[model samples]
Target: MVGAMSLRPRILSSFVGDRFLHSTPPLHQLFRYNPGSKHVTLQLSRTLSGLTNLLFNRRNLDELSNNKRKSLKPGKVSPRRPVPGHILRPPYVKSKQPPGIASGPEVHDEKGVEFMRASGRLAAQVLEYAGTLVKPGITTDEIDQAVHQMIIDNGAYPSPLGYGGFPKSVCTSVNECICHGIPDSRALEDGDIINIDVTVYLNGYHGDTSATFFCGDVDEEARQLVQVTKECLYKAILICAPGVDFKKIGKTIHDHADKYHYGVVRQFVGHGVGRAFHADPVILHFRNNDAGRMMLNQTFTIEPMLTIGSSNPLMWDDDWTVVTEDGSLSAQFEHTILITQDGAEILTQC
Candidate 1:
């Protein structure tokens, strides 16, 4: 599963600390949460000169010539769907809150690896079916319904349904949304791009995967952003192995994003996934000096977020949806992987 990286100091807890990974980006703005206040405050940092010029690729020019379109708005979310009694729910489902990331890496035994592979395959199959329903006029809620049914039919649970009170069975991030978008009643429009994040729990293990898809008649600029974002994920995955430093994943993604002048989002990152949805060591998608190493039999995820404009995010009121501050287009891709003896095996593949 993917989550926003925050540096807020907090008392250590099983669930709380894992969600608060630390990182400091050269962001033009910073977000601060005021506990007494209901919402997070968006604080401005020193502006980077020529940033506008730097982000003004073909996408920005096209938006200017055509006049910018409306930013993403929240649609009416349907009531929480119910799972069958026969399906076993994750422990966090009892609390209706996510148990924070697990303490250590998700290192598994040989038999445990097989369980992981089962869940990962189901997640990939579900995600593939979800992508097929991405045509214009189809509401994201419809997609969620189809996905929810398929997972249950396979005797698996939809991992996102109740974790931290997430309302949807799957995350449907459309257009500028960076991550954690809830599926709602809004219909997909022509030329829109979307990211579908799917995770499933089966036989006591969790599998996570996601992909960005296009609606009818998408523009070349958005298409390029989606393609490059996907390439960044694969490029990062290729460098992963038993002894590889975790920082190399960030470097691999950051360097490739730099080549196209795209912005690599720093707030959200990948994590260890297996028995629990999110675990450690925290995987950063941008360049940094985080000192962590991969080990054999370890399983985790590598997801990257890339944007055509400002990488800074503006969180919506629901506290789940994350969108680009400048309303620029963003795209992401993710997969769960296992560190094998020679290299890494992508578990979340069909």
Candidate 2:
């Protein structure tokens, strides 16, 4: 079972407006229901309270909508553009593509390995460029626009554009958001931590990578969380080798995170990335007993999401963005790696 964290519900009473109360009935008039019952009941008072609650809830909802609109300014959907004819697109982008095109991990031959390497390099480069654009006051939508252009300029296709109907080219997860954050108009503020995930398709192969970045100066606790999360990823990666048990990766990650009092996200696990954006032997980031073994030429990703509070995540209503259940800060790092003759190669290294 996935871990559950305590959540601190945000009270938005401050956002309530007087307009919601204008139609509400007065307290005396609200008490119209019968109060007498053989079973001894306060039906009238209960009815009055229910009416009052209904109005208050309506007001709260209005305030929430207004606050969301105000906080996210200049947010716009990314425009669809044409890809170069020579560029190879994932099967999902092709009309009437076969379903099995995206499946389990497959071993790559010499030429296929080279294609994977090129795609990995481009993904890493795009992520590095996106990191440079991180700063206070910039909306995530702006970052998405820049990343979209960068991927296209490099003669590649952004893998996430239409995969599973995802709207953006890159994922920009901020603060409490754990992963798959859809870029929006929310302007980043000082001390905010964000993760920029980039995946590009080149020469019929896919490369994926992501890292948590700080916006301006962050607090000591947040900084440590990001640092430890990064360490968890590397520690897991260090154990990758031909014949190594896949379970060891999660064990290492869990052990390191436990020492720091951080929570490891279990809902989402890393996976093979190459011809398909996601495939198998599923890579878990917490303790597990999976029997899969690493093999040479097998390429996969190792990404660990660590949370400052509960590791349990609650999905946003959009069905994509994942946030900590407790609304605490979370950080993640990812890299595509290839098992080699002796050890492993970090294909997505910048």
Candidate 3:
């Protein structure tokens, strides 16, 4: 098959905080590691300025030694709409409210958000279960099996399972991999870090979530990357609300990561996911993102994939897994949220 397409180019600041990442041309290279493993590190330069990219040199992984790197046909998505997205399954359907939540603030179409709440709770449950399922001998495929049934048992569907023909239900991105890591026969080893990206479909709507967790004993850098990446997600949320500039979110997140000299991956972005798996109002986590206004009722995921060295990612031949260009550990956290009259409600909440 043809390689995965390169996404639209983006504009980002020169320095996230102290690490001046501004170069007229993005620095790209291929870094090598274990010959039998798919976990290669990268030394990527920030490539988030502009919207046009050639299909052949997507992330420009020239410095790395991997020959399988190639551009992909970018996935097609709706950029904006009056309403954000939903999880209510069988699309174009309504909700059946539960008890207390129905009488609360979400009365008229208010309870409609419950599906997201349910997705969040279940996602948390799944995260909890998946974390427990990790071990030195367990395979990623086993992890996927557990995550898949957890959704079914909760009367929900795994959103990633056929999303744009994505083969897995949960994204299991291990060390050195940025995001979109598919489950495989690979077993966990000592001191490994894996990030699980989960999205559930409930009541016709969608709930998106992701968290990087420790597999066994991790390195100091790995621990810091996971903690700071998650902190960046929450910090980005703090700057989110109605009428807020979308670019500031990235600026704040990048600034925060820069303080630690962390690398913020620029390849993939958090997007609107609700009634549809992925929706309008794409949320970019780096500065200079050409994002529009964050109007009321707008919903999206604010996931920032941070790298240890630089924020560049290169795709493998399978056209899915994305690894850091600098060969450093990467961690990310995501939340599906909605913009309220005041702040924002994390729909995937308990």
Model number with the top lDDT:
1
Superposition-based RMSD of candidate 1 using all C-alpha atoms, in angstroms:
4.9
- Per-residue lDDT of model 3, residues 194-296, tens digit only: 8888877777766778888887777676798799988999888887888888888889887887777666665455666556554444455766545467867
Residues 221-259 of candidate 1 have per-residue lDDT tens digits of 899999999999999888988889999999999889888
TM-score of each model, paired residue for residue: 0.87, 0.76, 0.71
Whichever of 2 and 3 has more TM-score, that candidate is: 2
Instruction: Look at candidate 2 and tell me the lDDT of residue 234.
Output: 92
Put down candidate 2 lDDT per residue, 1-350, tens digits, no spaces: 01121111110000010001111122112111111210111123567535523432122334334432112122455565456777777887753222222245657999989998999999999999999999999988889889988988888999877665567888888987878888887888888889999999988898999999999988787899999999998988889999999999999998998787677766466877788776666677767666779999999989998887665455554545766654677899999999999788999977
TM-score, structure 2 vs. true? 0.76
Worst 10 residues of 3 by lDDT: 97-106
Question: Against the unseen true structure, what C-alpha lDDT does each candidate score?
Answer: 0.80, 0.71, 0.61
Cα-based lDDT at residue 87, candidate 2: 72
Model 2: lDDT of residue 39: 13
Better by TM-score, candidate 2 or 1: 1
* Candidate 1: stretches off by over 4 Å: 1-7, 10-68
How high a TM-score does candidate 1 get?
0.87
lDDT, model 2: 0.71
Which of 1 and 3 is the better model by TM-score? 1
